[model samples]
Target: MDGNTNEQPPAGEETPAGVRRRPWPLRRGAAPTGVRRSLRMAGVTLAVVLVSLAGVVLGVFAGGRVDTDIGPFQATLTLTPDTSGGTTVDIPPLGALLLDSHDGPTHLTVRLGALDQMRTEALIDDPASIQRASVSAVEDVRTGVMRLGLRTVASAVLATLLLAALVFRNVRRTALSGVLALVVSLGSLGAAAGTLRPQAIEEPRYEGLLVNAPAIVGDARRIANDYTRYAEQLQRLVGNVSQLYTTVSGLPVFEPAPDTTRVLHVSDMHLNPTGWSLIRTVVEQFDIDVVIDTGDITDWGSEPEASFVGSIGVLKRPYVYIRGNHDSGRTAAAVARQPNAIVLNNSTTTVAGLTIAGIGDPRFTPDKNTSPAGSGLTKPVAEQVIGAGEQLAATVRNSPRPVNIALVHDPASAGPLSGTCPLVLAGHTHARQVSMLPQQPGLGPTQLMVEGSTGGAGLRGLEGEKPTPLSMSVLYFDKDKLLQAYDDITVGGTGQAQVNLERHVIKDPQAGEPVPVTPTPTR
Candidate 1:
């Protein structure tokens, strides 16, 4: 051995004793430490970015349409990009049942895709099933989804590590370890996203008996934004339905009296979609012969607002609609599209065995005034209402039906037809009231009923005032085709709830009394 400190290894000669290993393949001077660090960090950064991008692509495109069966009800749902630049699930009402199950007056919402078996419990009427489905969904996510996500994350980490090793062959041992740690953490995040798989939602179900089920569907591409919101809404509806079943389970199931005509009078929906669902419920429960709506159906009566007209079109029952102050002729045109709707404006017609005549609001929409601003005794509001009432009174002058009912929007205009009509129904004021108007000597006495806003004062009603309960009247006719018992149902007032219905005995609707309610009540 030579005694030289700076000696190079001899060609083809193996090192004899204590020669140390190098941190890299190359000589120390050929590449500086800084260069090696740069290589390792750059490779790692690139690998991390690729992994994240892949994870995002997978997350966005992973979900597709899945069939969701909630007991006897079934519907298809999927999460896709929404026009609102979010994700949402679109579900058409499975049947009339779903079409009529609304959360509130105007808002219809459901998140069928977010419910795993566990969350679906709320939709079911039974307590045990809700518990089971909820537990199962949670377990599936924890045991199945978590395990699958871990596998994906681990695979991603291993692949990125191998690729980084290939690209940075000259990195130091310390730097390699650091790079591995960084890659694993980031890769774990990318893989964890797989755990968010909403496909599991298709499994959890609302399985059990349900008193009523609404159409549970909507655009759900926005589920990523807030799945909890839609999920909770479905829960509340399910809870309410459960409450209804619980309330009536012990009582006698109602069967209408023979040869009796039931008319459900609802007014001032004011574009509250919830009312239609309630209307459907009342009609089904009462075996109603005809459904009548005193208008203000649309708030502004604009073109876009016309879309809600489709809701009324779905009612399979006989429906009679009259225009109100907030309604336009176009509103009537929309009502005409509904197969069962009776357009009884300024015309006397017999429907459901009763003659009905109506007057359209004089002003239609407040902005769509009939009176061109003129120098007259009164402003447009009074002049318009009177003219419309006169037109209606003119048509009913000869008496069309023995039990003629007059439909108008304003109660002020309802009295003129007292002598002509035995029963007068009007809606415009957002409060409930009843009055007796003794007619001129020869005619029968008239009862003027002004129904409270069916929308609980509507969406606009929610502002500036304590919220009112949704209100409407169910008028029952006797074998003689005379008014007998009327139910004034109020749901969810400012401080009241649980679908309270009060039965009023109108011993003689012709007596023009206040129409006292019977103490018997159903919640």
Candidate 2:
């Protein structure tokens, strides 16, 4: 009997059932090879599918939603899926953050997609977290090299393929197929990660703000809460001015320019004499031909009644005063009384080579939290609110001189009217007590800024900081219609005894050339 044949069993090779000890050479040798080939192809196919899906989900979908925020003084992030419809994301005020002290240590909030979220979070906390997360997310996508996920499935497939190649020589280079896939997938993922989330500064100008976001967010939160509380108290205080402690004299003084544009961009005055005095100096020094008081001329509906009205008279330039929410009723009557002052209740004006449009406060206070002196708490009708926005639109549209400038008190209104006019000057968010760059889009790239009294800049308002303090923006427009110069006049006298003027020039975007203005003249 031959080994290949079925014959009587030998002693050692006897079958368990005592049958023939015949080895079917052809069938026995081919079984392992066939099984291995099938397993290898299946494993390779699975790896390809997973890598492809991950590329689509992470690269295509996640790349579009990258946005950043800084300052409420405490860096905290709330990430919600931006579902089919609209999404409302509430950025917390600094006061709301659960923090220990009012200073030190920054925080970061990162949002990752469903697939990589857990892995990414682990990497963020680990020693080489950032590097690992970024590498894992993109290794196969860009480099076409083997990544963990791709490599995992690839290895399994490759093992089977290697076995198959050994079994079936006619299969033609089965072992090398996985190597190609590994390289291609790794390269693809790496490319996708680099393109989508580069480690370098996305916006070089905003880099500082982004870096400082964690710490700033914490401080800003507490400041904002204090402001809101103060505003509530001040609202009641304005009803009885005798109780107020702060005065205009305590505010910073302004230095007027020798030559006058006659335009005054006074905003977030907050009825503090310090701010008013600074505004007055700027007006007189510049010999302003016209004054545009954007809003928040008064601290709140409260404060010494005379302070808000008197501050207007103090400006040497004839002014156009718009009502800010803080002024509410207190400043309206006073504005109406000023013969030289054009009181725009969401109206237009053409004065001194400028076509100016004004909008009153745009924020909707659901309830009359507090009323002006002697006036009962009153909630306005919906139409009145809508009408105010319409009036602003109409005012801009009807401007006789091709709308050169826009004036409003609340910086919030700027969001709607930013690119509409050549220049938009507003007050509310008084530069955040310590000013930084204007963080609004289409505003400026650099974080260069103006300081507010107790409140903040428009960025603060966006951060939910209420009743930003007093400051003024002075814009100098040349004859060619280019804004030659800009100035942020600080309004208070706390740290600085006198008014401080931080000025800069507008660089032309197309030319990348700076258009210089005369240095700010000293008082």
Candidate 3:
């Protein structure tokens, strides 16, 4: 053996028995002991270097294609490079997912090619199933970063604890171990935070995880940008194609008598002072016991503009509330300050004899609104809203007392509450302001509910043949639990003369109920 002091083995030669293995190359003029320590620190700190050398290997070998299942629908997702700049997806046998089958399973398939591009296909066996399927991918890098940081920290903590046990014996080691563990944990967390992407990547595949790639990149982008548009289109389609029952029956009705408490239901006031004043006046005149304003009290959230401040003193009774599509943090805060208001985003409250559960708005579908300002709740927010609504509804439905009434911002959202509550009051259309419906057979003489200006029509001031009053509605409950509604038109001023309007009661068709339902004490 040669008398060399160097610990490294000669190239292509078998290693000497005493030398320990090291990660760095042992070339001549290589790092000294101090330099090696600095170099090790640098190597770990440079995430790009670590990623290029190691992460790429993990991504290539450990990560495979992603698969997703939407209900009965299943899809195989793969990523391919985009011949174009970024990426686009190919929907194989295009439009197959739109098939209609009530009894069949809706399945989807996707294959990633490279980069982030993928090909998607829909299974058409059950056409109806395809329509019900809501497929999407979750590509949240923050979650992954947090998880990685936590795991690394846990490992560092354990290691520090072991080192303390060995180096400092019992007492000192225990305390020092805790300090070292905390330091290592923080260091690991910092490293993870630094490595995390600033902006979320579209087509995540482990390292670049590929889920439902098309959903992650294409459909999801549209959802994020134009949720209301998508939602509206979906609503139109569902209304046209779906045969699901819109009304649920077998619910006990509240009798329209004076003994029982009745809720004055109104929502989506949309900053309409006329509507607010009308509601308050009617409640006082008819002696309503409870008021439930489902949501959207303000047109633009925040402080009510000058136009809306007049509505502040109108409410006299405690009103249960749920936020609306237009409600913002600022609006919610303002509304919360009202002594008579109870904001129940996903909470329960009781008014009079009714256990009222409330939720805000439904998820914002891009198709829901036709405005350019991105005004309404988008799909994700709408979903959260709807989910909250559903949760509240379920809570109320499951309660000891039956839900007598439900107030929602949009009349369209009342579907879920229809049968659950004996009555559902919704007002988002602004009454269509102006509408024309063509005559159709079996639809009862074309059934027109159009409005004309008060003076222009045949009737007198605030009387017959007037415009549809921008008004509030009161639900009447009697001793027997049968319920009815009364509409109040709004005038102006502080006294009863300024706010009182004519009330129209909606008669029940199934009961063959009589027209001109007389108002009993609304309380």
Candidate 4:
């Protein structure tokens, strides 16, 4: 009876004929504790992997290629995990960013993270320079930057390992582990979003590179269509630029002492903002005490350009202004608003220890709104122009200072005043010329200097013709407050101060000679 009881039930004793309970392969009840724990840990590992994968997908979506536009320039931004595991942006050649004259070297420098950087000392004058310039500085990249990036990755890995160990330990620990994992994921996402695309950029200093390639092409086409002699115009532009760098090398780079007075003669700014920076450089370089602007501050002589008149503030020195035919009364009013600006319209004043007298343009344009006699006035106000010149000459002749200087907009207006002052500075010819007019009775030979359009013939010059040289002159004063030296400097738009380009004509005041000068080789 006992044997019968032990072997009585069949394999499917209480089940249907073909549907038997599948054996779990173990005769023991339930699974062993180790097996159960192993399964649970496997699940935890899988979940961690899934969450990490999701985070990666989210980061990829959040951080995609970004585009930026600054003025007429265009550039692309990209995200990259550097060798040290830190996020960084790789910016494609920004093309030309219209470098701020106050910032940076004349070269392109890639600033990555904090200490990772690379730079090319050469300016991006040609398009090809972009590629050559993108080299990374191995030392800068590997030093401080690597340490920072490694530290970040080490922290993330440490957090992940600790969370994983806790999560695999037991079900009760899952909640704590999950919370920590979520915190890590959130931090990762935030870091990805913040570092992938910088909210703003500190524009790099570059020169002569294409900004918006399409826009640049369109501008070129428009220029060609408007100017009949496009080739000739371009040739002239390049020629003048070459000549400028060539001849300026022959001039001395004087390092005048402090407490000395230097005069900067900037004429026909023509609303070209570039001239302001040029003026500032000359002021600091030469220890200039005064800046004399010979009008034509704007191209159109319109009220809208009045704000540009505030450029006088950039000089940070006493500025003397005389109205040009291209300048209007509104422009004069703007210049007068500056605390450091003195409007010598048919008036005489002392500045930087020198006597300066000047007159305003007489012609307001007969029709007024038609055109400038120079740019806005439709017709030249001839009678008034000539008459004003005569009066300004008569008034400044008796100035008390031995070194009397006259500032006039148009050289034509300055003709009658040649011998009236010790030195007469004028613009409008768009050419640089210095001459000693026939000596007056009591006056030593009076110097009549006509400076090139500091704006390179204003903006109009860029349209009809190849602009004349962008030029300016510096006047040095002796301890006796007498005129010491007058030097001329020319520049190209690129601001590539080349010591060697070609040959050019440099005039010498003392020798009264037009010397052919060759540029020195770059250091």
Ranking by lDDT: 1, 4, 2, 3
RMSD values for the candidates in order, in angstroms, are 14.0, 22.0, 21.5, 14.8
How many residue pairs of model 4 clash at the backbone?
Answer: 7
Question: For model 2, how does the per-residue alpha-carbon lDDT over 1-523 read when each residue is reduced to its tens digit?
Answer: 4676645454457677766655444554466877899999888666544544343333323222332222101112321122121112222210121211111111112221112323322321232333343355453322221222344344435544554455445354444434543454344434333443232222222222133444333355465455445433433322222211122212233222344353556555443333433444455555567777665554334322323364455454677877777565645776767667787766677777677777776543311222221133235543344455456756676666677666655443444453456565554444432122234465432212222432233223323423333355556666644455556554222222233345555556322234333322122
Residue pairs in clash, model 4:
371-376, 371-377, 371-378, 372-375, 372-376, 372-377, 373-377
Better of 1 and 3 by lDDT: 1
lDDT of 3 by residue, 179-243 (tens): 54456446433443344342433433321222323432245444333333322232232222111
Model-by-model lDDT, in order? Answer: 0.56, 0.43, 0.41, 0.54
Error of 3 at 332 (Å): 2.3
> lDDT, candidate 3, residue 304?
20
Q: What ordering of candidates by TM-score runs from best to worst?
A: 1, 4, 2, 3
* Winning model by lDDT: 1
Candidate 4 lDDT by residue in tens digits, 359-436: 887754211221222343234455566677788887886666543688776666666775566678887667777766
Determine which window of 10 residues in candidate 1 has minimal summed lDDT: 100-109
User: Which regions of candidate 1 are displaced past 4 Å?
Assistant: 1-256, 366-380, 518-523
RMSD to the native, candidate 3?
Answer: 21.5
